[model samples]
Target chain A: MIVAEQKPLDEIRDLIADAGKVLVVGCGTCVTVCFAGGEKEAGILATSLRMASKLNGNAQDVTHLTVQRQCEWEYLDPIEEQIRQAEVVVSLGCGVGVQALAEHFPQAWVVPGLNTSFMGLPTEQGVWEERCAACGSCILGLTGGICPIARCAKQLLNGPCGGSQDGVCEVNAETPCAWQLIYDRLKAHDRLDLLMEIQPPKDWSTSRDGGPRRITREDLRLVAEQVE
Target chain B: MSAADQVPLQIVAYCCHYCAYAAADLAGVLRLRYPGEPKIVELPCTGRLDVLEVLHAFEHGADGVMVAGCLEGDCHFQVGNLNARRRVAMVKDLLNQIGLEPERIEMFNMSSAMASQFAAAAEEMTARVRTLGPNPLREESVS
Candidate 1:
């Protein structure tokens, strides 16, 4: 899921400094689980902004609205009245959600309240580790379940670098060498022979196709004739 | 003396029902006299305390806030006091970001038998807030 963290309070304050009315919008999907930009966070941020504004002698009205998923237009459709009421809209969603709000409501000035960090999952209670680079390709079958593109510091495909020591990556001591883990797993499965088939430079054509990536399913799309 | 001390101060103390609440009750029973600035709001546990609740107190005119929970390792709910401590610390950081005194809010832990500690906490927070003056938000809204 997309993980994000709130921006600095001063930066957020500066973003909405000129506005007399501010609305905080939160996404209920990925950010809710990560405790970044959920309903509770939106409420806290709205309250904090109100208090901070008052303390600074800035008279401002701050309110909040949270949608089930900010990335979808239907989920955001119901809050049009709330969004229209504010001079500035602060989105506590991921980068996609922020852009969705901005795109959906052209009149409202939508500003991001969170710094969209990465696509990762929570490793523990409060720890999150990146797992997928979304490179639009799969190499897990060649390697082990561990992802070298996301887990490895250098994204080494062929084998571990010489700098690895004691199964730990030299790039980051905390990071276990992805290639080492792959080798160990393959050896356990008696498939260590796969490593000998040297992997050349990865095909990144699908990942970076010169522009923003998009996919359209002809089966799901309808034509003007069908709409008529 | 700071200009803050010249104005009236109101400090809200959110006390856990299991420990700090009972401690404050014991202080009252033991005829302990402390500053009356700290208004007590009882909760089931400090873990139940939310950042919005603390901010609500400040927005509604509180000059300072004190979250009183069970002792660090003695929380009846295991990590309730610890959670309350984290929330208190978070609120302090928020206050600092807002140009307010981070010392305006604090977290204290005590058992039911620690009446003296409860009174001392009250006196300490009262003095601290008095030195800091009335909440700037309150001053801003009033003007």
Candidate 2:
């Protein structure tokens, strides 16, 4: 899921300004799962903004609403009424959700309430660690389910860099050596032979190389064109 | 309550429906008196308790808060009580980092049969809040 962290309270105050009506939109899927831009978080942010606005002497009407998935257009259509009424929309979602809202409502100003951190999962309660980079490729098969692109500080595909010390990255001892873990996992699987194959330089074209990539599934195509 | 007569503490209690809420009701039925300063909010399950919600409660006016859930392995929702417990710990760390006392937030696990335990927990939280005084958020509001 997309992981995000709430921006500091003081920063949020600057976004709303003296705007009288503001809509705080939350995503119920990824952000909610990660405990960042979820329905409950939206309510809290709205309430906090309201309290802060009151404190500043100029009251603002802040409404909180959550969509099933803020990245998709279909899920956000339900909030058209609220979005149209507000002077600005404060998105409590990740970067994707904020951009999607901006695209959906071109006239309304959109502000992000959470900092889009990374694609990750909760290792335990309240602890979300990075997991994927969406580099437009999959290398998990050879590395035992962990992606070097996201985990390794240097994104090294081969065995541990010379900087790895005592199973920790030299760049920062706090970070576990990502490649070290990959080497250990592959060794345990008895597939040391896989390491011998020099990984080709990653192709950047399929990723952010050619602007934003769009996928169309011809097999699951909607028949909306037939209605015309 | 007037500032002079006020208890100088405000607490928010998150009571789970299956156990803690029942215990609170039982406390009422048993006529076991406790501090009136603690405000109670009943939830479906402790697992549904979100850290943001707890922070929101505190930001509004709560000086201290407690998550009252079913005993471990006894939650109606299986592991919701445990989830709430974990979140309360995170909330405590976040609170402490922000200069609020870690003692301001707590988690109590008990079965519905433990009505006396609920009262005792309330008393304990109330006393702790008294020591900490009112929430800084409330202090800021008044000043």
Winning candidate number (TM-score): 1
lDDT of 1 at A17: 98
lDDT of 1 by residue, A144-176 (tens): 687899988888899988988999999789878
Q: Any residue pairs clashing in model 2, and if so which? A: none
Write one digit per residue (lDDT tens) for candidate 2, span A30-70: 99998788888888778777756654667789989999999
Candidate 2 overall Cα lDDT vs. reference?
Answer: 0.85
**lDDT (0 to 1) per candidate:** 0.90, 0.85
Q: Which portions of model 2 show Cα errors greater than 4 Å?
A: A141-145, A209-228, B1-3, B6-143
In candidate 1 the C-alpha lDDT for residue A138 amounts to 89
| Candidate 2 to native Cα RMSD, angstroms | 5.5
TM-score of chain A, all candidates: 0.95, 0.93
